[model samples]
Target: MSSRLINEYLREDKLPHIWCPGCSHGITMRAIVKAIDNLNIEKNNICIVSGIGCSSRAPGYMDFNTLHTTHGRALAFATGIKMANPKLKVIVITGDGDCAAIGGNHLIHAARRNIDITTIVFNNNIYGMTGGQYSPTTPQGERGTTAPFGNIDKNFNLCNLVKAAGATYTGRSTAYHVNMITKLVEEGIKNKGFSFIETLSICPTYYGRKNKKGNVVDMMNYLKNNSINVKAAEKLSDEQLKDKIIVGELYKTQEPEYTEEYKKIIESFQKER
Candidate 1:
């Protein structure tokens, strides 16, 4: 039974989504719409851009102005949309692999430019759409189809990476933390410059089954118990922080948005003409 808000925000004809049972992508997607509903942003003014992945499929089921782009290219497309039509609210939906691996350059450059776009990454730790391959955010030593024994590559801390690259806002939340996800997304939308959010979604079929992380209920409990708010983690030591999720709005600051800067440049050129 879909809520009125879901029916209103989501494309009803696409009901009975293809995501596996216990997949947390649905939870994060709802949070996106709920944030929009809570903020009361004009639906028609919103534009959703997504790259190829399980998370990317969201745009197809959304009623907003949607753009489904090539693998790891959502941010590039979204950047163009925001620059061409500064009035539209451009939001990106991406998975860990889609944003942090092949699309890593675009992600960093966008953050560096301080573009006024909201990027939400569903970091499931594995490339669920590509047969459970290890993603850039996969925990070191975690098993994936590509890493039969365990993942040897170091995982990326997306929040820290975006913050260092100059995003105006950065946040992290898990599917188990619904309210926090919604709030973070709302804050990201309200932010004037590049805003980034990473949600730890459960990929029960691939990640969970392969890693023996138990059923969806077990994974949810893991998120709830192993999570600490950014402020709370301040008092904890490195050892204590291990295996714990540092949740909440991790970073924020004021910055000139890219679109507005470009607009000023255009105005100056017109004055000269």
Candidate 2:
């Protein structure tokens, strides 16, 4: 039997999500749900924001307060939500292009502000929804619609970017590593400042087919075999680390969250008045 909370919180009308087979979106969605369940936060206190893309479609399915905003604007909207309420748990779900490319500025500024919001970047390395256009996180030499010969650009290391931008919590995980991803989401929500999770999802239908990578199972197997925990990766050399996925918490530290600081300033002014 399903719990009343799960049943009541899930938008059953949106059952059977449109992500293709071997697509990691569904898995990532479950991970989010598991995290919320573990945290025991009331549905009313949670708000999900997403930008335009396959990943952005997530808000429509989740039961929480959701806003499916314009492309690369999820974070912008989420910032407003956090600033306006301060008490709500805001989460932004975005794809590689949605976050690293078009929404790059919003992402970095949000981290810089150390807002009390969790940003989950679903990095499949390609623009899955609007044809397989190469994204900022797409690995060099990877083939895509825009890069038939090969991509000449370097990929964005999202964890490093967010950490440098002052996020209080940063982590990376893949869909194949579902348990850890769920745990990371749980941790991000509980964190007091900006929390960023870069999830390496598989868009086998678009990214795989264009890049000569096999189906979903093959990608999952690759992730399982290639990934090493960050701690373990420290001991490996560049040659040994080639083609390997590093999934784990990269950095974490406590910092005064943006909203809390703003609230304090308001209270102080009122006291003075």
Candidate 3:
């Protein structure tokens, strides 16, 4: 299945991905492809967009209409692509820093508009591509090259942020739970409005070494032990949930999608004319 997916969806020439050994970005990326395949969406009907970051490299390797845009601007570019052709399934592959830090505004506005786009955030906690800088999602008190003394800012709960901002569908999953990532992404793609799926990727090279998160195995173990499915969490006490990663579909609802609404206005004007 992996080989078939590689040949069908991935650019074989880019066989060697640049992510460090044990990095979870690869797992997250493959899950995305699996979701697309599960949907059986035509290769020509998909448009994958990305910004500058380790995770953004996915679009280049994916066999689709891909756009490699500037840092933090993938969503802006994706918005245009989605507006121009609502028939196309637009997917934005972005990292924590690329999506939540520099591209924060775009994230919120896109969600607010309820655009028909599936945004998958490969949140590895720290900036992996542009050095080991602390990202917006970096847990408070975690160490990074930019926060050698320990990060002081409160990390953003990205799932909560997007849900609050009006994303019709939202989910959170980790690289350890590869199947869940694929499931959430598949559901996100099926949604008619903005959809956000945050995949907690592991940056073992920088984030791990700097924060003393142990080796890749240890990091994977952490995800396995610390994550609680949202359904299971409902039965756990607040104390039991402390410091636990909530994983699963967080929110879902129906709303008027942006491009469709715009089309309705254009039709109304044409009728009046």
Candidate 4:
């Protein structure tokens, strides 16, 4: 099944992705492909956009209408594509820094507008491509190249941020939870308004070595042991949930999608004319 999906949806010429050995971006990428396949969406109708970062490299390898935009601007470019052709299924593949740091405004505004775009954030906690810099999602007290001692900033809860910013759908999953990532992404795609899915990936080369997170298997094990599904978390106490990663859909609701509302205004003007 994996080989068949790769043959059908991936650019074989780009074989052997550049992510470090044990990095989980590839797993998250595969989940995206599987979600698209499950929906049976035509390749031609999908537009995958990305900004500068490790995760952004995914669009280049994906067999679809892909846009490799400037750093922190994937959401801006995606917004244009969505506005120009509302019928297209626009998906943005971005990293934690690319999306939440430099592209933070775009993220919030896009959500505020409730645009019909699925944004999948491959958050590896650190700035993997640019260097081992601490990212917006990097846990406080974690070590990074920029923070040799420890990071003092409070990390952002991305799912909560997006949901509060007006995203109609929001969810969180990790590379260890591959099936859940696919399921959240699939559901996000099916939603009519802005959708955000944060996939916690592993940056073994940088994040692991800096913070002593162990190897790929160890990181995966940590994710498995520390994460609690939102539904299951309901029964757990605050102490049981401390430092625990919340997985599964965090929020979902219907809203006026930007493109659809824009189309309605155009139609109204045409009728008046």
Cα RMSD, model 2: 1.5
Worst 10 residues of 4 by lDDT: 1-10
What value does the lDDT take at residue 29 in candidate 1? 93
Stretches of model 2 off by over 4 angstroms after superposition = 1-8
CA-lDDT, candidates in order: 0.95, 0.91, 0.95, 0.95
Residue-level lDDT tens digits of model 4 in 1-273:
349999999998888888899999999999999999999999999999999999999998999999999999999999999999989999999999999999999999999999999999999999999789999999999999999999999999998898999999999999999999999999999999999999999999999999998888999999999999999999999998999999999999999999989999999999998
**Residue-wise C-alpha lDDT for candidate 1, range 1-273, written one tens digit per residue:** 678988899998997789999999989999999999999999999999999999999999888999999999999999999999999999999999999999999999999999999999999999998799999998999999999999999999999999999999999999999999999999999999999999999999999999999999999999999999999999989999998999999999999999999999999999998
TM-score for predicted model 1 compared with the true structure: 0.99
User: Could you give candidate 2's per-residue lDDT for residues 1-273 as a string of tens digits?
Assistant: 355644666787777778888899888988888899888899899999999999998888899999999999899999999999988999999998998889999999999999999999888999999999999988999989999999999988999999999999999999999999999999999999999998999989889999878877898888888899999999989999988888998889998889888999999999998
Give the winner by lDDT.
4
TM-scores for the candidates: 0.99, 0.96, 0.98, 0.98
**Which of the two, 2 or 4, has more TM-score?**
4
Of the candidates numbered 1 and 2, which has the greater TM-score value? Answer: 1
Q: Model 2 compared with the native: what TM-score?
A: 0.96
